[model samples]
Target: MSCSGFQPISLEKPTPEDEELSDKLMEKVRSVGGFDSEETKESKGAVLLKLDQIAKEFTELLSSAMSSTEQVSGECHIKILTSGLHGLGVPTNKPDIDVLFVGSRLVSRLRFFSLFYIMLRRKEGVKDTNAAPDAFVPVIRATVDNVEVDIVFAGFPSKDIIPGTLELRDDNILKGLDMESVRSLNWCRVNAEILHLVPEVDNFRNTLRAILVWAKRRGIYSSCLGFLGRMSYAILVAKICQLYPHALPSDLIKAFFELFSKWKWSWQCPVLLKPSTENWEFGDLAWDPRDNPKDRAHVMPIVYPIHPHINSTFNVTESSLQIMKKEFNEGFKVVSEVHNNEACWSKIFEEFKFFDEFQHFMVVTASAADDGRFRRWVGMVQSKIRNLVNFLEPRNCISSIRVNTEHFSPVSETNKYVRRWFVGLVSQRPLRAKDLRSPIDKFKSMTVLQARRVGFYTEDMKLEAAYVDRHQVEDMRKENSHFGAPTLSNTAAVGTGEQPSTSSVAEKTCQYDETTLPIPPKVRKTE
Candidate 1:
């Protein structure tokens, strides 16, 4: 196992004070929903069982449905396996169930996505199926039996084995795999590697659960908006646990904030549970700033432990980096004071006052014609919004930007599918909305331009960023803004009278790249 870190910074046991605090920490952690109950875990497992049956049925149906000319020479075996937090034996409430369909050489990914997608729609309780065959890691996202499931595909070089016979430890498992398949498998591989590398699985999991709750409540949990994700947080906690292998969960959590609050981060420094070098690596370039200049540009590199090591925090930007550092420093003070009996553990998990953090706020809104379209549109907007932050950084009038990672759905918008993301901004005094117009406009245009280039842009999709002041934000609070817009109309809202800006443009046809379009698959049913 590659769980050994660079070196043990300290192997000290927890002091009496830390142990005493731990008792309270565990209580507080449970109270704040840090861990899931037995009932919830069982419920999630049941849902996975249903998905497994559905997937197996789809595979059988696919064999009989495909043309003989298109079929492979041998039998196909497929296994549906779980990964991510649930796979790690620690899960949060409303967790997205991540699974992979591991197939023998006979099954291709194209068939898996298309046929299974069709199969899902035919099943009862399977809805909201969206296929992004051309995504960074192609996936068929769907909600099965009321549980969100992300299904990706990977094919073995030879015939797939029986369920429980395939082991990831064998380095030869990676040979001859396509890049997309390798990336898809990395999610499961890294999760397993982390479990192997941790000194104490229970303590590591407890610390991870507690830290995740704290990060989410503190508004620094999302990977989409340039902050540490669940896996990054896992790798980080595993590294810390390795350093203090003898400590309890309480002490490890304490050490986490204390060490990282003042951590000296640079291009050369990255948080790795195992060393960066691995023998299982495919030929793809790993995250080596010394060798690849582009890798050095990442602000917060939490290296994933697998072949072809990647920076989990590659999306992190300078402003987001500053925001996280500030949170860490504050967290250090809170955690340190707990040891001194000056503060309590509950104080550490307090919710981040995002709405009250700034003078001016920008409400980024996305509206589309349907739920599927809205979900797809929202994903595109969230991915590109970080670039908008990067663009605003060069402006002299703005000092900082804080994106609230949570998104909301409009409570009363019957006309369209709408979602809103609020951004907290710190302005350099003498604020003026007109000054932000050009940059805000650029952000909107860039979003649409990307949607166009990706061939997903549609006329019904609307993106807007309206600049509003503190007083106007209060009005929104009274209107129940957190859940969603109180009364969003197809028209617009006027008042604070802050005049929330509406972004729109003349409709134009998208110039889709003909070569990149996914071919629609045709299936023939057989009795």
Candidate 2:
């Protein structure tokens, strides 16, 4: 049951020149705070070792629990499926660990999830165990020894017993499985698919590491924030490798920016692999633009290389698409500059200049009673902020809405749990009457609606909206030195790419209910 068809190609040790390039890339990534230093790597390894121990302890305990329950009959297998193991993980400041508990008959997800939650609760130093059963991707997230761990369960039929050494690459493994099971498997499957699709593994990994840093520094990395997520980023990089199979890592890196910079996403989606009709055996829809009308709706589709073959970048909005296009062009220009003797890698991964770009901004703050509540509440609100931007963009009143994409904690010790997010607003014209008030009211209502959806809206849990000018934002940043520049202008399009307004931009505007106005989703979902 080990990796059946996909075996990683072994390579000789990196030569001196390769080492030099690797060091340079690592330095560049480290400069941007993403490089995994030796000490950090050892610490992460220790965390994984501890996680493995916990996984083994939990599996044994679960087995005992199942044995006592008359419904449990067969053995359960525990497997660790980490993005890091598949070489897809970038050396980010925070590393995520995923564990899958594959069970056989009588072990329902609810039962398994409940038992694991109980087990983790009883275990020493396992804190903040939240088993979200009704979530879109139901998972049990907890902190074990201060390392974040996400746990999910996959149960096979009564006759089916998953081996400990099982690899999910087999299509038969997925047959008759539910969407959640498919999702659990995809944690590892997508990485495998990306790695296999690329021509050279090292070339892909190093190139991806560089791109990851660039994306983070430039503030367009959040998939939930309507930008490319890890999966989409991986596939796009793999596609570059597919295009230039024999290119070195450095060349591939440059070509990646160059190719995607000029990519006509409006005309054709970026798909690394074609949709296989045979893949539908598992009842998941294969991504076929011709067959699935929904697929055509993706503004900048980066189709998943596996079944349930949907666009991973479907969360990208028209505005985010425009921002990404600008980034690609900027990235290419930076890389090209480095190609000349004029620049270094740091120039490509430079921190974004966000705060100085706009005159007005809408600052949204989510205050929670505790650290745990703050994390959950702020995350729910942040994910939906793009929806607010999407609502404003097409109305033609607001020129552009840019999300800061970073969260800041309030400076006051009394408000330690308060987290704030800022959205840069570009007014299409001078504010006339309540024109500004309408969009603000709409945004405030949307945030409340989102908080309610997460069941996080409560009396003590407060959501505040305040409009601040550039001077006010600067003062706030000075009060909280840790906060980044409070500007959305970092995402502003470069050059004369039609800056969202005509010369009559100074005209006064009105704010109304606009009941007749159409508002699109933060990102359009394929039907």
Q: Each prediction's Cα lDDT score?
A: 0.70, 0.61
What are the per-residue Cα lDDT tens digits for candidate 2 across 1-527?
A: 11112232233344565456556766776666555557656656776677666656655655665556446456655555564222365545554455566666645675555544555655787776665554444566677767666665666764345566665555667777776677666656676777767878877877777777778678887665677765677777787777666665656677777777777775154555544444475332454667567667667777667665656665578888888888888988887776665777778878778787788787888787876666566655665566667766776667777778776776886777777777887886763435556665776786666556545466666777777878878877766636532121111111100111111001111111223222112111110
Where model 2 places Cα greater than 4 Å from the true spot, the runs are: 1-23, 68-72, 84-95, 158-161, 275-295, 431-433, 450-456, 481-527
Candidate 2, clashing residue pairs? Answer: 354-487, 355-486, 355-487, 435-511
The clash tally of candidate 2 reads 4
Question: Which residues of candidate 1, in runs, are more than 4 Å off?
Answer: 1-5, 15-17, 65-72, 160-163, 278-285, 413-416, 480-523
Question: Pairing residues by index, what is the TM-score of model 1?
Answer: 0.88
| Per-residue accuracy of model 1 over 1-527 as CA lDDT, tens digit each | 12234778788877887677777898898897777777767777887888788768866766555444465455656887776677777776653577877887767787676666666766888777766555556666667777766677888766644356556644567788886677677767887888888888988988888888888888887666667777778888998888888888888888888777667676667888766665345433457787678777888788877776777777789999999989888988898888788988889999898887888888888888877667667767766677778878888889999988777765555644777778888888867878778878898998898778766688999999888888986765564434621110000111100010112111111222323433233343331
Report the backbone clash tally of model 1.
2
Cα RMSD of predicted structure 2: 11.4
Candidate 1: Cα lDDT at 71:
50
Error of 1 at 437 (Å): 2.3
TM-score to true structure, per model: 0.88, 0.81
